[model samples]
Target chain A: MAKENKEVLLQVQGLKQHFPIKGSRNVIRAVDGVSFDLYKGETLGLVGESGCGKSTTVRAIDQLYRPTAGNVLFEGVDLATLKQKPLIAARKNMQMVFQDPYGSLNPRMTVSQILSEPLQIYSQRKIINMTKEEISRRVDELMEIVGLSRFFKNRYPHEFSGGQKQRIGIGRALALNPKLLLLDEPVSALDVSIQAQVLNLLDDLQKEFDLTYLFIAHDLAVVEHISDRVAVMYLGIIAELSPANDLYVEPLHPYTQALLSAVPIPDPKIERTRERIVLEGDVPSPDTERHGCYFYDRCPKRMEKCKGSIPELKAVKGDHQVACFLYE
Target chain B: MENKTILEVKDLKTYFRTDAGIVKAVDGVSFRLDKGETLGLVGESGSGKSVTNMSIMKLIPMPPGKIVGGEVLLDGVDILKLNEKEMSRIRGNRISMIFQDPMTALNPYLRISTQLIETIRLHQGLDKAEARKKAIEMLKLVGIPAAERRIDAYPHQFSGGMRQRVMIAIALSCNPEILIADEPTTALDVTIQAQILDLIKDLSEKLETAVIMITHDLGVVAGMCDNVCVMYAGRIVERAPVDDLFESPKHPYTNGLIQSIPRLDEKGSGRLFSIDGQPPNVIDLPECCPFHPRCEKAMDVCTRKYPPVVSLEGKREVACWLYEENK
Candidate 1:
């Protein structure tokens, strides 16, 4: 966890993802001007509620969605400038695990087929040239690493449980031994018991492979558990960013404070006594053009200046950044 | 002194006649809801939490889903014995429900006013104009902005959070004695979920309605409910007050569930307490404790025979072989 010699594996700068409305000229700014640095072998969590553009940010970083602006530099190479073939080649070091285990995997294919299909397809890219026996052996190794029994590889996805299906998904993501793993709500779909199992597995795998993770999730608890550093996003921008512990303990931004407060802790005594800052309104539509702060309408400490100018993410405390007029 | 029991479920056994086998969806589930209280039915998917609620509502299809045995008492009267017409009268009037997804629960083709007014008129016997006014009031009560105008809008016109507010409006339109919300806020955001939960809590308190909240989230249970029932493989494994359940969970399955979830309060040690193995198949559950396979402290007797329910002090109860001697 030492930062002295840690290399920045993924440097995302001024990334913007805008979707054009079908009939109208207006566009939805799903991810607008977000930037972050993911250190090698350290997990950086992206936490936000629904429609806050956390998923879009991850997707843009994964190059699944072509960004409208800005650069995604993976080990100094700008991924946004790459063509389809080259991008595919670049994606070999970066893989993603989705939230829904049931929908992510192919239902028709057996687990063995699902695991091997990735290797077979990527082998055509010539990054991995393996014989049939080597492929089988690697597939089994992936399964074992993910804690899935090798004997259950022949079973269809439908036959396995939610946790098992997720393990298979993780196995497929790790099939190529990617340096960076983009986990988008990996454990959110599983049961609490199974979720913990998967979280522990993810932790062990991180150490075993030195995997740097962009752990994207809505659950604050899971994010705090898995992430070394955490970024709080709201309406397509980073509201606050700091070490995971510091962010949770003393959130600088009002949005981060409100979001952390809104999450109900399991302890009945603490929950009853804790003062929650429940925001009044829903997240505003991304289609609306705003000159001021995106969270101005809902911020508890909104000022007259917040209505006129957008606050940049400025450093407040040690390594902690906040985007608000109060911080300015 | 007898606490006024609004609803009581005794040995409820509901099964689905699937091609695979008779799936014991809700097997011998029992619980009680007092007047103006919230009871949390916590469980994973297929754990029979939803089915138990469906059985109480008489919403289960008879051919596929049959209530083989049970006594569901609403105000000391057994509702399971009631016919379809009588049950229909009870539903949406005395007992109402809000489903999981607001988008799917509300008809997209129909306007919000139409859905709300229809339920209002049918349940309250109000005139069309009067029902429309009442529907708008309900919507406003659930914090829908511009209720008078938004009432005429279709379900698609509203956001996910707003649609959920509409669902709450319809559910609370009749001001029923009991309200059953099945994963009501699961589809919404945390902030939105907080808003909806506050609305439900506030409305239930104001109306003095007993609520049966069926959800998979323990945090929601801790914040909202007075009592909690942890279910597994179609059986209630533990029943305790919310405070007791969270502080010192009794059953092994309950303990595993609490320890498994990462808490927002404190940092974890890079590992979580995990319950190994999947839940047992409901169709052919073992004669012993269904959780024995996954239980860390499972004994030989656990796999040999079913554990009896042990009632501890402070109204806590657990079904596990570890506490078998106390039964």
Candidate 2:
């Protein structure tokens, strides 16, 4: 839960990312008018399916992809309008951990080299000529933070296992001591046994470093486990946002309810007894513009009011916001 | 023969001759499936769940992959001893399989009607028109709307969920006695996964077809399987009824796997219960219990040798040193 007195570290206002086709007028509306806030020391989980724009939203916020429209405010300053030097300085406080541990880290470089590269890049801005001793000490500290031993620092990324490779990725992300971590499905690629280990390590690191995280994943169980607040995305828009437990227990949006019900429980007795709400049809293509709700085509409880107009996200309960008109 | 067992695997051992060494993919795995029953083969990436099913199918390539020792009895007949001609006849007609990715399993260039009808023609020996008619019926049976019009479309034209439905339609067209669905719904979204699971369950019941569902997800096993076999490092560590396994798992590995996954119905302690180490390397596994290094309750004996299967009441069985004394 976010404390009332905590400062808003990052605020995303109406973030839209649209990619235009080269030969056609069609645009892939990846992220459309998404908004959210992150407290100084909290994990905000962004949950959605593959094409739901959670990845695009995170990239836009990280400035990996500039937004087609709207603004990403990091401590009340728009990242889109910042100068090159200022943006580089601002990015020093924010870091992103990618999904594929194998592809995200450089395969050619040793763990020591990978960890030192970030420090070397940021050293010129800090204006301190880093001595070899200081860089080596920092690398050892980073490896220790991510539960890797100093003995294996010289090994390349290929020599390490999937879990160990993920540890290196996390270590490199923390090399510069960033305040906010944009973790995009960090544990999804790992095996179940190793996933839990990496997840625990991440939880511990967040507290130890006083870091805020924008955690993105598709697994509802994982998101509910780690997130203080959970946002459900559908067709490039946030369908609902609520406290993690509350969202799980009593979801406001139809899409959220369907997603929750679809997660098969591990207990056979409970799984057999529970009624599942299987939505009809596939997710519509994002290239086509829908006049109303993105979920209107599949929603069973859809009505006349659901067509020809979009519904803005409004608070339905305490700290629970839904974009559906059912609450109204 | 007296029992209702539809498929029985006895001492299945599959190995691969790699550059490093002989990798024991499925080391002495055994299980049984009755008529109309679903047996879930649950395991991690290298745990050999897929290899076990492939060995049964006689699909392992001979040069590198070999089924060195095993008897896959489909209705009291050894499938492994059968020649290539005999195996091919039985493969699609009696025991069929649906792969993980429908896009790859389906040919991109061919029409949906072509792929589905070819299987029907091959298995049932029906003529072109009859096979095409049966294919459309199968498509409608799996819940693809406008089957007549969409039958001419290519695999890319259909959505992921619909392509999977087409795959399921092709798998179930011949109404095989056994269906091997290896992660059938893993590629689809959750809502679509639910629909596909329901369709499989409903269709299997109607046709009285036994299913061998291979997947890593415990949740899918809980909903779909009557019996569950938890595989770790090429061995069945635990086997029991789904309810029994969920309520009281005996093996330390099974317990760890259950605890490691976050449950949607319950709020966790914030600190996740994680298993300590990676799965043992199959190429050069230790002689002792392979999971002893990571098992929290590992005794001295656990590190010395692999434990024998300890049978308990209610058809429950576990291979662990903790239960060796009880046995």
Candidate 3:
């Protein structure tokens, strides 16, 4: 396939990762044949259900789980085929900010040691063995950057609240100063008031550092908030991909339509007026095989051909790609 | 226009006695629920939304958590007056709860039927066969197909959304007049969360049951609730009709929350209006308004003295000094 402007920072092509089921010979298609392009300085929100390969795709991109097939070209280098040393070296340019602040960090490590470990692994010797004054200054700078106070440096994860702890997580991620940050539901675990603070902090940091984000979340409202472009994934495929505004207001795929309808609009009047598209049935197990569309069972506008042949992602409008039989 | 109080919580304060110091989780929180109406308890985590709900049901333990003050009245009957045996009998029979994580709520080893039957027999006083019959009905009511066959399946056999349905079915098994749902769809995907919310709304309407939905998502409350109570630092900061709360939120904390939430409609808006400070420690909550530390419209009185509830006509009450400006 031919590409447009070369501003693309990461190009994921036909990424497939299948985790073998415990006893059964069948493989759970955690992420299968997924493809998307993330541009420089753009926040691409990946929205989906719990089991849907959103997390797996991000993990695969981070090289935590190597893809069984396909390619992840990071800055024109194929990361899927890289070995141990090169992969770890490539990791310097890519950092992952996990979801649970409490579970993500080692509880035993103080905030100072936690931040310094990354610096020791990636930074120079002179920078590593700097005086206590210098180390505290650097940690304080990072802490202040994430809106955390200087006093929180010596505190453990148990001492700080969920929101304050997440700030420390963000500070550690920024320590690497990577070009790309893979945020996996970064603010989902925090409280509503704290979520906004962290989100605003992320926005400010992104602008200041010119960082590109692969923002993964389950909530469309938060996704719509930060994403320049959005991708709707179901069972392990990109069902809809378009700019955030175009995708939310004028969704082409039935799944996208239902997802938009399902979100409870914060306005009571609008909510009362809006007809909800309550989808029937549960998400099929990833191990289950489908002949055509992944969303066919619950899709409101499911067509006969939707079962006959798997629909390919075709452009419904300019820059709007949808994989549904309705377009055909 | 009508006063039909289903649940009346009076000066309800549930404190967790920890070694570091006592955590005054639900500090002097008071509210009323009307029959067939939805009241939303909105707050960030640790604001005690869940703690308040748990205390009303007497789920909080003694060593760590205790309801130190106030009475919880349900249909003119003070639930707090009941002893352990009485409280146990009334719980799950009069009022039920559905949690955020369905997996944790349902037993993985037991069949869905076994779980549902236990709830039915314990509360409804049904025989084994009769409980089984009701379990089938509930499964069907929650839109689980082949309900009879699926009822015999384990929790692992069902999907995340279906397990949530089972949780709801168990919660509604006793047909309680009041249902307390604490972030019922928080971790689920967007589509599944939507369906669960839709189910709650449809079922609540059909049963004409009062619902106290505890959630951080303003979107969920806007759609499912008739009225909302915004809490911060263990205090109800604002209470109003859902629409009015959204259109004109008077409390600075409420104001901050509404602005901070990334809206589905507000596509190209700038960065969300984040509240500048953290929620104060519940143990060391401000003597004045709890939200005064982070409030943009904080006044001198806001720091030294607590603000009184200012009434706006039509059941809206805001606890903020800026509402005095409106007056």
Candidate 4:
């Protein structure tokens, strides 16, 4: 699974995002010192349970919720310190697709308007000077590229189905032709039938455009299907990062083993017979200052050492990094 | 069949009168549940799994949604023909349903204690103190820790997985005979999903109640269900033992569903092959096989006419022309 070029497109270093609780005087470490690299033209799947800071980390990368402290180097540019204008300028080359397509798109805007506005802003051409005919032509091309028909160009967001609305969202994101896409559970909202269609479409689009993707999702099967390398996030920290094939086949970390064991296999016989590692208790409160591994309380294989020091993510095998005292 | 049948639904059709058309959400669907067995109803969204469950409980709204037809027979009694007085007694006491979204299914304003106890008080005819005691016990039953403290907390205070457990506790308050969970873990993460599913399995063993689990996740069905029912566009496409369904799926739709679920074994074999198209629009569906449009192996007869249930010797039934006697 090793890449020939192996060029890093985006590198996140010690990214920390701590939000102050409304009444309490303590901070909720949503994304506490998370770091990972996104290689060019490759998809890195980020997975975790809800409140494990998977969404918070993606929000930080998309600059929607800026990090409290830490560096986000997109092509060696520090986004943490970038001014408003530069942030806007940088956004032209970066785009996001959210979990809920219904809530993300403006209900009133036509598909052409939604697609054209981004182009109109980035191109800097006089708005009125560009005729309606020209703007629609470009929108149609974008639709066709996304495998959506041009018949949907004039339709409102409400008129289209959930899958079609998602296509519109993809079309809008593609309007800018961004270098990196922070897709946050983009296919989670759709049904399995449509989800597969959209996922396959994404795979084709990635190869066609040579786009880099930061896919944040809770689905292992889908993420493992789509991702090149996947980072398993738990309580705002990555427990394991490895090639998707390796992670599934030979997972090292106890948490990864538990996580993989917990996933029900599609084969009924195997699913019935396989022994599952059930993690104990809910994910510990990130608002509290946690000791040891964030998963120590729930780790089925937790040891006495796991309660003392937080294990660093270190290489256990070729391109496979695991953060656990057992591995250490 | 006397001892085997737990719940039987016959010719149940639930419809919604929308502005566009009358959506036949659950069109002439019939199935039976065995005692202490989990029947997994698998389908895409709008395939009427949820609607069928809701219709059985008579929870469908009057103006837009109506039961329209069929009888929901639980333990030889026709519950569908029963009046409101009878249904209310059966609703939470004999049969309970767990919705997909725990956040919305639970009241944002009320504490878990209040929600759980109110149902117990109404159904079980318990006093305030007695209901409170039962609620705490029910909470503990679902594996929620420190139930005495967590019981009084509102839905917002709990996590997604925990809130779902609360919903389960409420559903199991009266120790119902049947539990209909529609996409119970769809909103939660996979890790938590496994936990909840295991909890359900353990609880089912303890309670010995029939469970109708409706979901799109074939992986979950494979693990959790005793029998799996594949639904497509308001019709049950295939119904068989879980092992038989996965090992030798006769129906094209059933085969497609298993293929669509990405597995570790599928890696380095071939790319993920999706079912070609979406489920048919429920309203005004065509008179042929509902799966004809997306079906890779569609035949002339598949589009011209619908396939009847090709019943096998031991309890397997598939609705595909490929299994027809004439074919």
Q: For model 1, what share of native contacts is present?
A: 0.78
Q: Model 4, A1-328: lDDT tens per residue? A: 2398888888899998999999999999999889888889988999887888888898898788889988899988988889877787888778988899999999989888888988887666332345567766789899998787798788888888888788888889988778888899999889876787788888878888889899988888888999999999988899999999999898888778878888878888888788888777778888988778888887778789889888998887888998887866
lDDT of 4 by residue, B86-180 (tens): 89999989999898899999999998898999999999899999999999999989988899998989999998899999999999999999999
lDDT of 1 by residue, A244-296 (tens): 99998898899999999989888889888988898977788999778999999
Evaluated with DockQ, which candidate comes out highest?
2
Model 2 chain B poorest 10 in a row by lDDT = B1-10
TM-score of 2: 0.98
TM-score (C-alpha) between model 1 and the true structure: 0.98
Model 1, stretches more than 4 Å misplaced?
none
TM-scores for candidates 1 onward, in order: 0.98, 0.98, 0.94, 0.94
- Rank by DockQ, highest first: 2, 1, 3, 4
Q: Which 10-residue span in candidate 1 chain A carries the lowest summed lDDT?
A: A319-328
lDDT of 3 by residue, A1-328 (tens): 0235538999999999899888998999999789999998889999987888999999999889989898999999999999977888788778988999999888999888777667776555332355566656778899889887778778788888888888888888887678999999998887677788888888899999989999999878889988888999999999999988899889998888888888877888888899877777777788976778888888878878888778887787988999987776
lDDT of 2 by residue, A21-41 (tens): 788899999988899888899
Docking class of 3: medium
Better of 1 and 3 by lDDT: 1
Worst ten in a row by lDDT for model 1 chain B: B318-327
